[model samples]
Target: MSKKVAVLVAGSWGTALASVLAANQLDVIMWTRGEDQATEINNKHTNQRFLPDAELSPRIQATTDMAKAVEGASAVLIVAPSSAMRSVAHQLKAHYKPEMLIIHATKGFETESLNRMSTVISEELECEEGRVVVLSGPSHAEEVVKRCPTTVVVASLDKASAEAAQGLFMNAYFRVYTNRDMIGVELAGAFKNIIALGAGMSDGLNFGDNAKAALLTRGLAEITRIGVEMGANPLTFSGLAGIGDLVVTATSQHSRNWRAGSLLGKGQKLDDVLNSMGMVVEGIRTTQAAHFISQKYGVQMPIADQLYHVLFQERQPRDAVEALMGRDPKTEMEVMTLETWEQWHS
Candidate 1:
């Protein structure tokens, strides 16, 4: 008999991961709220709206019933948008089993609570936080479904849980790495979205490579600063979850955050850009969350602060740029990592 896996909310990333599990010979059950989407996946094996031109594996199925989706599954993967994570996880609370491995691939903070996805899930489930694994890295759902070579990291405070998640997802085409730094992994994953939005806005403004490159560099610095302040390994930001994800999200056309930023840079209103995308742009909400997070941590997140203003305060994109440029000059060596780099260079 094949192993069973449950995936919450059949979005692009969720469906792509389900296909991976199906290919691994697991009975993958995807739970979605939409009757039409569930029917499309159950009968036609195609999720045209999300994964156009791709065929889902025969072993995969979709259902509107949450209980049916997770019932008797060995693992559950939550891929809902950050905004819906809490509610979905709460609905999942009734069906959640202690023995089942829990993993989440969503990459954003809860805007109102300023809590991470895992925290929200743990709060909803009333379980220890360490058991939940986070899946993140440079992997894009678009490329992953095509079986294009992809690598991702799974992290949990519990080593066994991380390894279990790794075993479930790793295969010939999809590679998985394990990390013990759950906080760092989660923080790096969420914070990078804010920078991607900035990078996209830069592109939309017709700023050439020079300007965009500078923005990415500074953006990484901002990410590192916050991650370090929040007890994340500074080196984690340099790893896949940090620099790798940041580079991909900030530059790639496949990145919804970068695309949303690009539209905003072209002087589109936040509402207009969001309406046009027709998909959840996690970075926008993250920027809003980060605005408060920065205050909580007492860390200065200049780029994220600018994005918060641009997305919510009606500040013009160019003006935000000017403000960033006009800020008081300070040596970048304020952080121990940069000072250490300076030491190495000297």
Candidate 2:
């Protein structure tokens, strides 16, 4: 018998993951927050607003009822925006089952608590340490549903959790790797969005490709620095969740972060840009969360700091870039390794 997997997402990415699971022959039930969306999925077998071109599997059901969605689910994939995670968890509390393995596919931090998606799920659901696994990488929702070749990481503190998650999503085109560093995985996934914005700004400025390349490279450096300080394995940043996701989000037109950054760079107001998209541009919220994390942990995330100032404080994007470029010159890794080492020593 196939395992039943409940996917909590109402957006394109959520639909894509559900499609992948259902294609793999799992009993997939996708839960959207709205009855209209659920109706569309259940009746039309297509999420018109999100994945218009792709057809969902008949095996895949949709529901707006949280209880029905969670019931009898052997595994649950949390793919809602970072902001909604806590509230969703609260709703799931009464129906929580010990056998359910929760996989977090969302990639943002809670601005209010600066907690990673997995951390928020653990706290809100009272999950055991290793029960919550995070799935992250360079996979884009648009491409994944098409069965384009994609690779992702399944990270958890427990080897078994990672292995179990790997078993759920691994396929010929969809490859899954396992890692033991949950902190690095989650941090790398969340922080890369902030950097992708910086890259997007470079594009909006019409700066040459050289500038975008520099921004992406340096942004990874910053991400690794903060991730290392927060007890993440620095090496993980070199892998899929860190540099890989950054490259994809920063360069691709499909990235909401890059799109938002492009608008900001073009001098559009943040609110205006977000209003135009009609979907959650997660980087906006993640920027605030990363900004707080940087200040709280004393991590020198120049890109995040500058992006935060630009997005929230109304600083000009050009001015933010100028300020960053004009900063006192030092060895690129000068402050990075030292701070990480110091944190380790302390």
lDDT of each: 0.91, 0.88
Q: Which residue ranges in model 1 land beyond 4 Å of their true spot?
A: 335-346
Could you tell me which 10 consecutive residues in candidate 2 have the lowest summed lDDT? 336-345
lDDT of 1 by residue, 1-346 (tens): 2299999989999999998998888999999999999999989999999989899997889999999999999999999999999999999999998898999999999988899999999999999999999999998899999999988899999999999999999999999999998998999999889999998999999988999898888888887778777777777888889888998899999999999999999988888998999999999899999999999988888899988998899999999999999999877666556554553346
Top-scoring candidate (lDDT) = 1
- Give each model a TM-score: 0.96, 0.96
Model 1 root mean square deviation, Cα atoms: 2.4
Q: Backbone clashes per model, in order? A: 3, 0
For model 2, residues 1-346, the per-residue Cα lDDT tens digits are 2379998876888888888888789998888778898888888888888877788889789898889888899899989888899998878888888778889889898887787888788888897767799999998899998999999999999898899999999999999999999999998988898988888888999997999988888888888887887889888999998888888999999998999999999999998999998888888998898888888888788888999999999999999989999999898658756656775557
Clashes of 1: 3
RMSD of 2: 1.9
